[model samples]
Target: MAVDLGQFDHPSWLTVAGTGLGYALILAVLTLTMFIVPWLVFSAL
Candidate 1:
């Protein structure tokens, strides 16, 4: 007899990878604008 698994469908790998990349992009943008740019401006003064 064959063993049976659950019937629920899982998410695709592409969807998971795309979501991770999008999150990283947003984090990088926020870090650059919020911290790096201001630091550079003030340090130059």
Candidate 2:
């Protein structure tokens, strides 16, 4: 499910920017949680 913006030049970048940012944010949160949970559990012990 990729976005195809090859036809449009300027607007293509604009549309993808928001979606890219959102995807990046989600990835960051998931990655952080993976490490944080393990650290918290070990520290508690």
Q: Write model 1 residue lDDT over 1-45, tens digit each, in one string.
A: 975554333466667888999999999999999999999999999
Off by over 4 Å in 1: 1-11
| TM-score, per-candidate, Cα-based | 0.73, 0.53
lDDT of 2 at 3: 91
Q: How displaced is residue 43 in candidate 1, in Å?
A: 0.5
Which 10 consecutive positions of candidate 1 have the poorest summed lDDT? 3-12
Q: lDDT values of the candidates? A: 0.86, 0.87
The backbone clash count of each candidate, in order, is 0, 0
Relative to the true structure, candidate 1 has a C-alpha RMSD (angstroms) of 5.0
lDDT of 2 at 29: 93
lDDT of 2 by residue, 1-45 (tens): 999867667876777998999999999899879998889989999
